[model samples]
Target: MKKVIKIAGILFVLLLCAAYFLPAVQSYSHIPGEIYILKGSSKTIDLGLPVKADVDSSGVVNISGETLEKGALMQSPLVIKPLNYGKATIELSIFGIPVKTVRVNVTESLTVIPGGQSIGVALDTRGALVVGITGVQVSDGKVENPAREAGMLPGDVIIRANGIEIQNAKQLMKIINETQGTLALKLDRNGRTIDIFVNPVHDPSDGKMRLGVWVRDNTAGVGTLTFIIPDTRQYGGLGHAITDLDTGSVLSVREGEIYFSEVIQINKGESGIPGEIKGFFSNSSGHMGNIEKNTEFGIYGKVFDDVDLSAFGEPIQVASRDEIKTGPAQILSTVDNEGVKAFSCQILRLNDQREPEQKGIVLQITDKELLEKTGGIIQGMSGSPIIQNGKLVGAVTHVFVNDPSKGYGLYADFMLGMLD
Candidate 1:
């Protein structure tokens, strides 16, 4: 009888051990590695586990309710109060065992007017982008691919040739046509610099020297505007980077512009077929802003003084990732001749992202009007502002090709960080 009691005690201790460690393992995915809080403001976060938090720098931030009772299965709230504009680290532990460390940044609160108007983006790449490699016919009736022979790929950006910086496809062509022998070329391949020597072949058809490579220097498209900062007049749109359709490489911005556009047509989306919004904007007038940077997050620039701000309404508060929850939301977008309108949607999933990511929110369109108009989220709807609980939470990023009603969104906090 004593042996049986001893064995039962051992089993109970093992069960308690599993309960303690199970939440510790799950905390890694629920808590972010870094978080930003507004200065002088307090934020309460629930990690779904009872844990203790310790701050490394007391001057920057302070933690309230630092300890939670052990053996409690319910989620515990940790209140973070930012004291100043600086940085600090918070270490989370369970029963004196450290589980995760989160970097906390105290920054000034920012508010911006959410934009849903359709805008035209005209971006000129920093250098000519090679889109394709083909064979060049020589005078001897033989074909040679000089670009491939020189180890050049389709996605390579020819930045310099023969010690001259190349700005456009026409300029690169001029340099190749004038070159006599093997030309030294500098290329930007996936952010890495490489130098190669390529022998230009004289094409019998055009009677001009050719590298047997197709290059493009500019790209243009229509997209919804995300937000506009009132203080700096800076604007962010697209919610994601613009890539070349042929090479699938992110376009490096040299100079670009955004213009006011009007939605002329909308092709309804269908299963396996992504629709698009067609709009027209004049290059001479309707200028809204200048594109300064094209990053993985989106395109950012300063807006012109003449930009119409009355259409976007008043500026709204921006919500951090932790502040966002899965529930009903609304997205501001322009689909037809009418101006921006709010459409109902639902936040299906929210990802706890430690690093910057584009697809952090999975959402589904639920508005019967929107579902009937565009057949759900379509192309050119990217960067549509998502409003939840009266706060700007995120923007539309991408659509699930298989399901037109479902799409991905990016956190507004990540987009705002790019402004800094």
Candidate 2:
């Protein structure tokens, strides 16, 4: 009896060992011994997030047994897994053998910016970014005034006041109020960004350190690109002044520069009030060609930096200004990506011999893209260049409150008139 029992025990142990070599068991599965892994696609890990994700490595291992196949010593998911962002590796022992190696990646922490992507459209990897200004004007002063005597010019846009960075108008005021000494001014003159020192005089009534000069940051707003001259390559647009509706006075040209601004925000049109394109401009200045004198036209200036890219270079051809009729046209402005977005509109009037301030042509939006994005012409898009019948025609200046898209344009020549 003892010998018989010993033989049975030996047989059972051998059978169990055989099952361990057999594949993982499944209800109606053919393959057994192969190790299987269940995983999902990699995910992005946003900033400030802790790591934890589901990798379904949940399966049972069946071992070959003497009398019948039986459950293995352990199943998966029993192995502890560590989670990371990009790629994670986990190790586990299967059936007392160091066999399976699992790899997982943390995808949640990635932002794939195209190789040569331009920051004019994209935010940083961490996102939530603001365009930095190299310099800007905060206040203005009268010509040959006390501020001027202190070396401050009328067009001197203040970059800093009292040794503090001047971001915007409000912040400039805050610094001026806090500083109780002679305030120094930093400025950008005629494309040369420089710091100019000046002291502020105390305002007796307000008891504040005040630089009597009216200061302004660099002028940044949306302006349409009018037509690109055939041989000159100079462009033109809005001829009038863009003033902060609040202050009736004209906005100073202290900082004579243009930037690529986008129409990010919008105030919809209503019964009485109309919609507008709300955008912000940065320190990135394009060609500082010419500022047109015709309020109805655009100025021509040489771009400070050369744009060889197709998006900004190589003017698209349009037949004679005469060929352009009252029909569809596209407006190129940077309210979104700083690239040209087309909007359909009717050519209200195409005047070849337009007035000094009147653009050679006039058009209205009939396309859906402009309507959806800008709700017709808004403030910032005033100098946006207009393209019609393949030729650079003019820029949008004013919007017909009644028909927002149906605004006026300054003739391309009028803008060119400002250039030497």
RMSD of each: 4.1, 24.6
User: TM-score of the candidate numbered 2?
Assistant: 0.44
Tell me the whole-model lDDT of each prediction, alpha carbons only: 0.88, 0.46
Q: lDDT tens digits, residues 1-420, model 2?
A: 999999999999999976754443221132121121222222221211111222333222111111112213333223322232233333334434444444432222111100111111111111001122222223343222336546654444455566665566677778767766666666654345666555555554556555555544433355555544444545444445543332232333423544455456777554345676665545553433334332324334433335533345454543323335677777665556545555566777866463365545667777676677656766656666566665655566677777676678765435545666
**Which candidate achieves the best lDDT against the true structure?**
1
In the range 45-146, model 1's lDDT, one tens digit per residue, is 677566767676767876663322222222467777787888888777777777788888888877999998899999999989999999988988899999
Pairs that collide, model 1: none
Global Cα lDDT for candidate 1: 0.88
